[model samples]
Target: MKALCRDCFWTGDEQPRRCPSCGSMRVVRHEELGVLGIAHLDCDAFYASVEKRDRPELRDVPLIVGGGVRGVVTTCCYIARMSGVRSAMPMFRARKLCPQATILKPDFQKYRTESRRIFDKVRDLTPLVQGLSLDEAWMDLSGTERLHGAPPAVTLARLQADIEADVGITVSIGLAPNKFLAKIASDLDKPRGFSVIGAAEATAFLATRPVGILPGVGPVMVQSLEKSGYRTVGDIARADLRDLADRFGQHGLHLHRLANGQDSRSVNPNEARKTISAETTFNEDLNRAEDLEDQLWPLCEKVARQLRAEGIAGRVAHLKLRRPDFQIVTRRRTLPVPTQTAKTLFAVARELLAAEPKGQPYRLIGAGLSDFVDGQEAGADFFAEGERRALKGEKAVDILRAKFGKGAVVTGRALKKE
Candidate 1:
């Protein structure tokens, strides 16, 4: 088919100046739109958009969804972006940029509800959806043509419309041969967009773009590549494999592959979440050991609850602290075995925290788990005896919390925080 009308779902053999059927100019044309299957979908300004959706008065107003004066901007609406506010900008800086913009604390429960509704529609199309974040994901529609009775592009276009109509939010979509190129295409346009990049022109299309466009090419890597006389992706694409490997080792070869539009990673539905964590900024910088421990317990409970809920356990426990001046410190310990127990999480995290300098003030505190494993391992014969008991103990608490409310049971240490 020559083009797609995003509004009316029209397809034909000739690309028209406007969608012939609807006469709407929101038409997309690409040579490989019919055959490509791997795609990336990203919700536009998700947090802010949800806020606007429920509060119609805020539809045209600038909205920022985040935390307190000391916190960072979680996200802001497009209208706020026009005034120079952006995600992760310091709250003070964001206020300076858009003084008139309304600021609301993040309502994650509401956001998650909306996210589930949106992805339920996506899962109805294909089960091969891999979430990159709450608002971003990679999708494989390779074999779904038979089920959907249309090409992936047409299916995705309808999906996009369905999201706007059903979920009251807009999403951008990128269709391409692989994950890397699809991700790049998703960002080529903003708000509500659909773009495509085919294998035939991938190299030439990426040639002039900066090396930083490739994944993992941060500021430091960009500086190193430029100093090595490699400025554009074309430079990396044309460089010899032996030369790249010799100069930068395995990472150089990885860069070369991406510059040439090669990404072998699949859209894996079961891809593990890398980490689960919870943290809180203090009202006052805390120096007392007792006060810090009080703060730490609640966070441990939060992380453990999520880990168990997701049916996963972590092989490592992590402790994080931020000093008053914003220098962050993170400490992690490899566990004897994976655990989803609050007792295990707190025990390991407490040891890591205690190792910090005595009476040192901290502006924030947190606990986390990583290096995930299946939660079923807790029942394995080889699983440690102590962790198994700890798991059982927590399961009792989980049962109580589920029956009553989260506040039905709480640790003495957490009560101290209360």
Candidate 2:
């Protein structure tokens, strides 16, 4: 099949602006559409969409989900996005741009729950699913046509429909010959979009695009490349590989390969997450350990909750402090046993904080867990009876929190004085 209607799932060999069978303008046509199986699926405005789903009244209105005025926006609905509000923009600025927007504090627990439901649906289709975040993932349906009795494209269309039907959320999909191109295709169209990229057109498709579109080519790298007379992907593709390597080292060689539409990376389902962490910049600098500890408590809980959600435990607890002068101080402690409990993480982080010099003001303090192992492997025989009991109690609290809202169970340490 050379063409498929995203809305109707009609397949044909001819390329048309609209599907001949269903008349949907959302038609994806490519030379390799039938052969390509690597895919990327990204939720559309994930956080905001979840909020809107829970509150149907917000569905048609502009919405922004984030922290307080002093904080930054996590995500905004398309209506707010059209008014210049964007993710990571200061809340104050976003409000100014979309004053009518309904602002809501983020409920990560809710988002995580919804994300898990969506991921479970994806996993049902293929075992080779690689989760990128709470809302995005990469899947390889390379050889599942016989099992599903349909091509990968048709299976993905059904998956998209299933997500919307069951999860109450929309997703955009990209099908391509490789991961890099699949990622690029996923962004070509968004908010319930389906796009495809094929091997035959990958090189020419990337040529006119800016080099910055390639992964890892940030603003600084773009400026450096432009200064060296390489302004576009086409330029990088035509440049001498040896010369590019000499100038930018291995990174240049990597860029050259990507520019020519070459990426050998596979979608590994068992890829290890380097770290799981949570951090927040304070509205004001904190000098006392008590104040820092209060802030650190919630962050530790957040990290622990993430570990539980991912079904992993960490062997190292990490503490990070940022001084007022922008100097960063990081401390790590290797635990005797891996843990996924917030109480254990906070205890270790608190000790690490106490070991630091007193009266040194910090603008930010964060906590993290690293060196992950399966959750079953954590808190094994190495943990004492008391520790095991504490873990059991914490797991019970987790169940309560999941049943109700996150506020269903709050530790005293996480409580804030009004």
**In candidate 2, how many Å is residue 313 off?**
1.6
Question: Residues 1-418, candidate 2, lDDT per residue (tens digit)?
Answer: 8888877799888989989898888888887888899999999999999999889999999999987765679999999999999898878799999999999988887998899899998999899998888999899999999999878998999899989988899999999988999999998888898899888888899998999999999998999999999988999999999999999999999999899889999999999888899887778789998999899988988898778877899999999998877778999999888888888899999999999999999977889999999998766865456557767887888899889987898777667722
Tell me the spans in candidate 2 whose CA falls farther than 4 Å from its real position: 219-227, 281-283, 308-310, 320-336, 351-364, 380-393, 396-412, 415-418
Number of the predicted model whose TM-score against the real structure is largest: 1
Clashing pairs in 1: none
- In order, what lDDT does every prediction score? 0.90, 0.89
Worst 10 residues of 2 by lDDT: 381-390
Clashing pairs counted in every model: 0, 0
Candidate 1 structure quality by residue, lDDT tens digits, 1-418: 7678998999887788799898999988887877899999999999999999999999998999988776779999999999999898878899999999999998877998899998988999999999988899999999888899988999999999999999999999999999999999998898899999999999999999999999998998999999998999999999999989998999999999999999999999999888899888776789998888888888888898888888988988999999989889999999888888878888998888889999899988989999998899753547488888888988999999899998898877777788
> What's the C-alpha lDDT at position 80 in model 2?
93
Model 1 lDDT at residue 320: 94
